[model samples]
Target: MMTLSNLTSPFPIFHFIGIPGLEAVHVWISIPFCCLYAIALSGNSMILFVIITEQSLHEPMYYFLSMLSATDLGLIISTMSTTLVVLWFNLREISLDGCIVQMFFLHGFTVIETGILVAMAFDRYVAICDPLRYNTILTNARILQIIFVILLRMIVLLVPTLLLLKRLSFCKTNILSHSYCYHPDVLKLACSDTKPNSFWGLTGLILTSGIDIPCIIISYIMIIRSVLSIASRTEQHKAFSTCVSHIAAVAIFYIPLVSLSLVHRFGQSSPKLVQTMMANIYLILPPVLNPVIYSLKTKQLRGALLKLLLSKNLPMSS
Candidate 1:
């Protein structure tokens, strides 16, 4: 069994994700990722703007939508800043401290993003399942409190794992197999035994991404049940259409997540570019598609977007 450490001097490692002979692909993907980042930032910014400006959107669903947009923007920034740096330099080596900070923010927003998604799903459930009580149940004060607590908990939960990772000895290998300082990727390169690292990291992942997924499922389950119970066909259609974007967003985000996990567990050392591509997709695609998904599927959001754009054009037209 040839170990990763046994590889030849200089490691012959490609700069992109670990895929050999696929550096060009990484560059190509980076171009689109930049585009995706722009879209995530701009689109989410627009959503935030519309939500804040429009008095009518002060309800629970829009409130959660705003929060979701904010978190998605954070998620994109956290994941892609380090990613773009790696691509620009084409450098595979990250210092231990740099790696730890990257890992910390990367997963910090990841947990909070998952929590935000779960919150949005619950908001939708309340709106659809208990419409009569939606106003009282998801008031501004309550929503703000929930968001604050979730954000605080996510940051606190992620910090200790990051600190634990920082305490490990690197044993001279500074080359990270992935583009960013992923916990598992960094742990793999550690000179010391990694069982503890792997165990805790997996535990963290399960708590954040893993646990949040099931909760999303349950929320949607209730949402679906409630939608079906509506007596009017028009109401049922409206409710289902409202959920289309959320379902699409969930699928877009999680599919890449599953793919990335599988690649990490199975494709370690295969090629750097492949690893890079997976990571890039994991970080970039969801944010890019999120606004697009919601704008196209959600009538209120689409109207708000169009009105905002038209308003900007009015001065030029005059």
Candidate 2:
């Protein structure tokens, strides 16, 4: 008697062909992605460390930035570490359990990242729109509790989703096209019926991304409205300037993700390289640009960075 579990025991394998034209293009493409990944990791790590050690940055805005930086760092690591291993060593075989674990972390971190972004948006909204209440609204104790609740909810929701995905009998072909075991890619390989998976997966994606994006949009909308109401031109400019970094960061994050989704659903025939590039952009670009955007746009952060740099160069100057 053949059992369903045993039938799916032959874990799937994946491979990338080094086609001549594509290979040449990939070499050039991979360099920048590698650089971006390094920068993202290093920059986010620096932000996290600075925020933790610097008492001056203990305020609500920098506290949220620290949390966001940590999440961004985790996001890049969750995606790129496996990708790097596969790309460099050409290791393609993934056990069923290994694949499931990867999917869980990938999905989990993505959800957490969105939650952190939402938190940051709310922080900004409180800061600019309700300055009098900012202290009460975003106190340390309250912010910590909110982050804890958000993380708890994200984990509790995502674990069941991944477990449900794991329960599906993967009797179909096991060759995953993408570098990671993304939910959509994994669902495509399930031998059992996937209507439930498809429905739930899409629903979850829609609900999560939908909720976070709208919250961000609404925050910025209110911020803009508040900016307009300010009578002083200089104050209005200062208020708007504070949000420029966040806007740049959000656009870089969402645009690539949305584009990748569109290409996946609509342009199935798009070249594999193109798909890979877009996927890498989502994974790499946001983190790479996030710290840069925030640091460069905020005079305080830029001053801090410059001071740190000057301190480092003081011995040489002497």
Which candidate ranks first by TM-score, i.e. highest? Answer: 2
List runs of model 1 lying over 4 Å from the truth.
1-20, 24-29, 269-272, 316-318
Q: Which ten residues in a row are the worst by lDDT in model 2?
A: 12-21
Backbone clash pairs for candidate 2 read: none
lDDT at position 246, candidate 1: 79
Instruction: Estimate the TM-score of every prediction.
Output: 0.87, 0.89
Q: Deviation in angstroms for 43 in model 2?
A: 0.8
Question: Which stretches of model 2 miss by more than 4 angstroms?
Answer: 1-30, 316-318
Clashing residue pairs in candidate 1 are 16-272, 16-273, 17-272, 17-276, 18-271, 18-272, 18-273, 19-271, 19-272, 19-273
**What are the per-residue Cα lDDT tens digits for candidate 2 across 1-318?**
877766664454433232224543544555766888889988998788777777777888888888878878888877675666565665667777777788777777778778877888898899999999999888889988978977896777777677776666776347665677776767777777878777777777776788889999999999999999999999999998888887787788789888987877788898876877777777778788889988888777777777776887887644
Q: What's the C-alpha lDDT at position 244 in model 1?
A: 81
Best by lDDT: 2
- C-alpha RMSD for every candidate: 4.1, 3.0
lDDT (CA) per prediction: 0.75, 0.77
